[model samples]
Target: MHLLEGVAAILVSVCIYAWAYGKHHGPGAPGWAKGQLFASLISVLLVALFPVGAGFVALGLTEAMTPASWAGLVALAVLPVAIWKAVPRLARRA
Candidate 1:
């Protein structure tokens, strides 16, 4: 379903962003922090659309054009800021 795929996409993107953040921001990775955020955001946007692609194929394009898809689009649009705030806290826990 679109909901499930959307949720999965968001979760995976956050995890990827978190990992990239932690990696580039680590102590030994000096001067790399400046570009890490952009790299992480680009990575998330490029990678997270896979599940939605599957949803389109699984449900058919016509069927997929529903409220859930709209919500997914909004969620994807908000994802960068969410990950920006959340990933730091999550990294601190680890």
Candidate 2:
């Protein structure tokens, strides 16, 4: 189960990273592009450990030991920048 999650996270992060790479180090939104690259890298690590939250819960452990929570936490931390940059293009398409 953990392996599957790790693989999925790796694939998702890699694909997004590949797409985001085009924006990074380019004549584009520097902060937004950098965030995507950074978020993707962090997400790969976080997502793999996301299930750690469930483990903590099962073991009556605190959230402090739950690495899974950081997956969404990190995503939330970076989401605004990505959305801020993408909304314009997304809105134009819609």
Candidate 3:
């Protein structure tokens, strides 16, 4: 049960981050995109680092997570963005 919940939280955080990242990053984007990108990065990082406690703070039925779990969450959280930056896009000339 705990593992499943932790996975879910990480997934949700990454998905939300991806949505915000896609919205802010692209061709012909607005000038404020950098700010948006920064905010989105911070947003995901916080959620990933404090998955359970974040929810428990409001609901008050959860316990805090350990440091190792936080590291794992960080890895999961950054994987998508890392791949995005590392992989090449289609139909593009460099």
Q: What's each prediction's TM-score?
A: 0.42, 0.30, 0.37
The per-model lDDT (C-alpha) reads 0.61, 0.47, 0.51
List of clashing residue pairs for candidate 3: none
Flag regions of model 2 displaced more than 4 Å: 25-31, 34-94
- Candidate 2's error at 68, in angstroms? 20
lDDT of 3 by residue, 1-94 (tens): 3433454455555555555455456665456755856776768676655567345332322435566456545655665675466333421222
Q: How accurate is candidate 3 locally (lDDT)?
A: 0.51
Best by TM-score: 1
Weakest ten-residue segment in model 2 by summed lDDT:
56-65
lDDT (Cα, 0-100) at 85 in candidate 1: 79
Model 1 TM-score relative to the real fold: 0.42
Ordered by lDDT, highest first, the candidates read 1, 3, 2
Error of 3 at 15 (Å): 0.8
